[model samples]
Target chain A: MTLTAKSITKNYKTRRRQVSVIYDGDITAKSGELTVISGRSGSGKTTLLSILGGLTKPSGGSVFYDENDIYSMSDDKLSRYRNAEIGFVPQGQGALSALTVFENLILPASLSGSKAKDRAEKLLERLGLSQLRDAYPRELSGGELRRLSVARALINSPSVIFADEPTNDLDDENSELVLQLLKEQAQGGAAVVIVSHEQAALKYADVTYRMDSGRLQREEK
Target chain B: MNINTLMLKNLIKRPLRTGVLVLTAALMTAAMFGGQAAAKSMRNGLDSLEQRLGADIIALPEEAQAKTDLENILLQGTPGYFYMNKQVADRIAAIDGVEKLSAQYFLVSANAECCTTKVQIIGFDEESDFTVKPWLKNTYSGRLGDNEILIGSELSTKVGSTLSLYGVECKTVGKLEETGTGLDTAVYATNETVQGLIKASQEKGIAVLSKHDPEEVISSVYIKVKDGFDINDVLSEINQTIDGVQAVRTKSMITGTADKLTVFSKGIGIVTIAACIISAVIMTAVFSALAGGRRREFAVLRTVGFSRKRLSSLVLSESFTVCLAGALLGLFLAGVAVFPFGRVIEKSTGLPYLSPDIGAAAGYAAFAAVAVILTGALSSAWAAYRLSHADTGSILREGD
Candidate 1:
């Protein structure tokens, strides 16, 4: 499956005026490839990723998964589609603090009425989080929380993955580990999209795009 | 994990919020149940008192009315020993519309000398009596002998116990049922036993009788008017015909007690309504705070693909569980307070209070449970709606 976005625009209305966050952004992520978008803070990298992932509605343009327009689906159908086919890794303490790491990992799959305990155990082992399966998110370190977020995103084994700033608070060793996991997910034939300002992430990206002032530019690397 | 498990974990994460909500609900239920039970008990006590009196008019000596308030004498069981001519019974019996008439004799026991406790003693003419005789028939078949007596249910003495009244020992043949009035504290006997006691008192220098003439003196007369006759007319005729006697209708005898009970019932009702309003307000505030604090968490769940309907269900389920538990706990506490320790409330209020039966208690508990659950659910519904319609992206973006 391929995820594509064209001419996406997002605007925010403040009390004083209406401000544009993203303008005419376009991107495509293909299976078996890692796509990276890098930008400074407030450059709308997260907004663009959110719009492409169907977490937010764009002011203009549309996102399609292999010719099916995601915006056209009803909220209920869209929620089901997202649960069954799309995965999102939000930035900063994304795991629910009330749940254990294991509970968080299986939540996405559980929402769709599918039993994924075996897959959850494998992911825990693969991410070196087996010991922290029963540990609540409050007890986890920043790096541990980031790894748990990644495990949760991959629990449903969706065709497309959208990750925002997954390596923001991680140490260099943990950041490299998380990047390697995303790369392995791409190699395993899922479309992986990462939004970050970390230049070190470029080494693992098959296509790199830089965002500036709500606009996107392809970087030849 | 299931939705219940998820809901429980969320509650456990915020222990203080959960505890406050549960406590408010518990207090509200307790007040409602306890107040209702107390009110019903008072009403039942009044009904029993009215049934036990059963007399259309009570004629007492005019001098006795001057000395003591007859209503107080009946309600608070004040020891009274005034006497009129025994011929007053014949005079009242001659009045028109008088269906039945009985004369009563009164005496009092000194502290620890004549009886185990200080109590008012009543002597009934069993042949002419209509009130106490029918009730006593339920427990005793034979007529009360000269030395036999019946004690009120509230008295510490039991049947077959020997009670010494002014040096005259009498066997307790039966115990009367509770009437939640001064009658519960009285002792009943035949005029023969009362005359014996008066003679004993005279010998002991107690001077209980006005003229030491038990054979020719009676304290009061009770009359039942015919069914079709107006009680007021009978009472007026008796007062007009009789020379030195004052007549009072039994229905008007307990006006003071009834007034006190009405005031108490109204007070409890107002308190119950205030408690309900306060609990509802607190629940609304608590739910709003919960929604605000957990916005990001709800947003996360939504992004993870929980439908708006499912999210709303989760909120409602959590509220229902808490409300049910709190209501049950409150009802249990109310039962404990009302059933075993009801006398405390009675003593505090200085009015008769009886616990309602098991069925009534259960009905009150069920009502409290439904009320609490509905209040909690409705209060939280607004918050749940807002959460269901919240913008997921903004919540995620604004996450701490």
Candidate 2:
């Protein structure tokens, strides 16, 4: 398993109330595989992905990458792991609104300590975003916005990619285009985790895991 | 994104907000710089006066109050006197520790027919004196002569015509350079000419001058100590030996009205500095408000995997850029304001001109800019640091 979660849990402490978002859970995604985490809204799908990507901490269990507990490392090390090892694509609009399309894609690559101008240009060309390179996030359509987010994530060239709702706001044609890109990454020997509640996403995922209250139960293969 | 590029992008994102913020920073910066510049002007003026009055000890009337009044012809007050016998100067010069000496011969020429305006006449031995000689940058008038009178440069503008000396008319011989003192507004003549005028004025019942040739007396002698001689010992000896003459040492002079002037100059500077500090606090508040309004943008940056450290660098970059612009602008404006006003201030008042120092204008400018930058940096850094600890999920949901 390239990325693994072993019984992770998280609780939100607030002035008004204490909310348990994610219960104990274990899920794994290996290189050259596609794992789809399917759940209803508020089923802790996004919460599980945040812990695996080292963005948010789990209250109980620890996440491991190639058998080393990711939580044991220092903040700087985890940040590097998130930057260079695991690529993250949040909501389609999580692409920075203030930055231009080219700037958004270049951010992840720059943080990873690579200044490859040629590669960024090629990525924009590959995603058909060359014409919209100077456009800001607010100017992008739903379909163009999703392509830009994917560009931002893939620009760092990480071994694993975690995408939350890659097809949430896309039309059917644009959704198929996004799913095809994910399938290509898995075929190219990268572990790809897609967090979605839509049943349409499962048709393309090689392995499907149903997240019920943060527990992963294999539903299809 | 790289630190510099990210900071540039963030500032350009909201041009209007950034422009207004920059203006606020510049105003505070100007106050800090301009106040310090005023203090520097005062320091420079005081130093100039100190250099001119290089006497080790000054001898005057027994009552210090009388001496002060006599000195008032330079605006001390009309002029009063308790005369020392003409022989007294020689007697003091012959003292054991006294090296060399000179005395003043003061004469008044108020409401004279030479010009519509009134003027004061102060006669010092031009041969052995250091007062006006050091400041004579350029002499466009007569050189120092025995019985010839020299006019102040500005005096010529009023009374360039000839004047009658004791019922004998003579041309205004020469003019002295601008010395930033009452001398600039007075006519300079020989000690003999002044005494001759004093004699005639007393006979005419214009002033209380001596009936005889005034005993050839000089008012207030300045004594310099021979090297390796204790100045305090000489002061004590003169006090004990001379019955009606008083000796004022260097230290006593710094505590006199001259010292009060120095204290007042510093007080002005302090009030100006306090005002600058208040403006800097206001600047900090302005920057904090800016960072707070941009919280959602910062959260989006966090999602893109920018670390808290990188976020801090971005804020500081903004601060440095704004400070640099504000400092340069403030310095340029202050230079424009101070140079002309300094002369006007000197001309309006009989008191000396004020200046903190030469390099201090720019130094104060930099100091103010750095203070503003550091304050903005601290507030922005703290706000962004807090942004990192925020719940990413909540921020995203709110944006949705």
Candidate 3:
């Protein structure tokens, strides 16, 4: 599947005034390739990824998964679509603190009433989180938590993957491990999109885009 | 994980908040069930009293002090007695609207050789009686022979046992059913046996009624008014025409107790409603704060594909579990107070109190449980709505 965003715009309305966050943002992540969007902190990279992942509605734009416009669907239908097709790794700690590591990893799959225990165990082993499978998120280290989040995003084997600074608090070894997992998912015919400011992510990007002042500009690679 | 597991995990992880929610539900349910149970007992007591009191009016000696002594004697089992000339029963019989009349003789037994406590002895003419005999028929169908006696339910004397009163031995024939009234502590026998006891008391040098013959005096008369005749008018005519006797309506004797019951019921209603409302409000505020604290967590769940309806269901499930546990506990507490110690409550209030039967008790328990759970869910509904409709993008991006 291919995720394409066209002419996306977002505005934050407050009591004082409306602040425009995104303007004419355009990006596409195709199957079998890694799409990278890198920018400064306030460049609205997360917002664009949110819109493409169907987590947030765009103010004025359309996101297409193949030929289907996602925003046109109802909230229930959109949630199901995201559950089956998109995997979102939001910034910071996203693991539910109440659940054990294994429980958190299989939560998205369990939402659809499917059992992914074997797949979860495999992901836990591959992410080096096997020993901490029964541990809580609070008990795990920062790198362990980061790896748990990456493993969770890949649990359901979603067709499209969205990772927002997936390696934010990880060391060099763990960062390389997480990037290699994303690259492996892309090689297995998944549309992989990563938002980051890390220089280490550039070597694996099949296509790179720069976000400056809420606008997307492609870089020839 | 499944939704149930997730909900259980959330409650277990936050022990203090969950405890507060459970205790809130418990308090609300306890107030409601306890009040309702007490009110129901009072109603049952009233019905029992009405059934047991077969007479519409009672005529006592003019000096019986109906409010202070008579009510205490009948409602609280404080034994007392007064005497008037037997001719007063004939005079009341001739009054207008007096359809039937039965004369009873009452005497307070001293702490004699037979028993440790003073007891009220009631003697009734077996042929003309309408009130006591009908209830006593359930236990014994034979006529009460001379020297035979019937005891009230509260008495520990067993059937076939003998009770000696004033040097006269009376065989215990049967036991009356519980009426939840002061009458439960009384002993019943034929007027002939009472006359014998009076003679025995006089012979034993007891100073009670020494100058009067037992056959010449009676204690009170139970009057049944004819159908289609108003009871109040009969009461007035009996009081006006009869000398040395005061006529009283049975309902008038019960009116004070009924009024007290109404007030008690109203107070319970008010307190129950207030407690429920206060608990609901507190729960709403607490659940709202909890949802706000878990705002980011909910947003993460949304990203994992939890719909708004699913999130709300999760919240409702948690609240429901807490309420169910609390409701059972509250019911157990209320039952412990209201069921076993019913007689103590009745005596303390100076009113009749009978507990509801098992079937009715079960129904009330079920209703209380459902009502408490519904209240909890309704209180948490606002929190669930806000949590589900939150801006997932903003909350998640805030962490960046």
Residues B1-400, candidate 2: write the lDDT tens digits.
5635777676678787667657656666666676566555645555554555567888886876845654444322243345566676788888899988777765566355455555666667766665545555444344554445666654554334577644535456555554334455666666667776776667666764653355466667778889999999998888889878998884465345466556756775676566556655665676678666766666556656667666666777787776666666766776677665865655443345445545766578778788767755664566566666665555554544
Over 4 Å off, model 2: A126-128, A141-143, A212-216, B1-3, B24-28, B55-123, B127-130, B134-143, B146-280, B303-305, B345-351, B354-370, B388-394
In model 1, residue pairs whose N, Cα or C atoms come closer than 3 Å (at least 3 residues apart or on different chains), thus clashing, are none
TM-score, cand. 1 vs. native: 0.91
* lDDT score, candidate 2: 0.69
- Candidate no. 2 TM-score: 0.73
Candidate 3 per-residue lDDT, tens place, B196-290, comes to: 88888888888577767898999889999999999999999988888888888888888999999999899989999999999889888898998
Q: Is the docking of candidate 3 incorrect, acceptable, medium or high quality?
A: medium
Listed in order, each prediction's TM-score against the native is 0.91, 0.73, 0.93
lDDT winner between 1 and 3, please give it: 3
If both were scored by TM-score, which would come out higher, candidate 1 or candidate 3?
3
How close to the true structure is residue A216 of candidate 2, measured as C-alpha lDDT?
71
Error of 1 at B278 (Å): 1.0
Q: What is the lDDT of residue A142 in candidate 2?
A: 81
TM-score of chain B of each: 0.90, 0.71, 0.90
Docking class of 1: medium
Best TM-score among the predictions, by candidate number: 3
The clash number for model 3 is 0
Residue A110 alpha-carbon offset, candidate 3, angstroms: 1.8
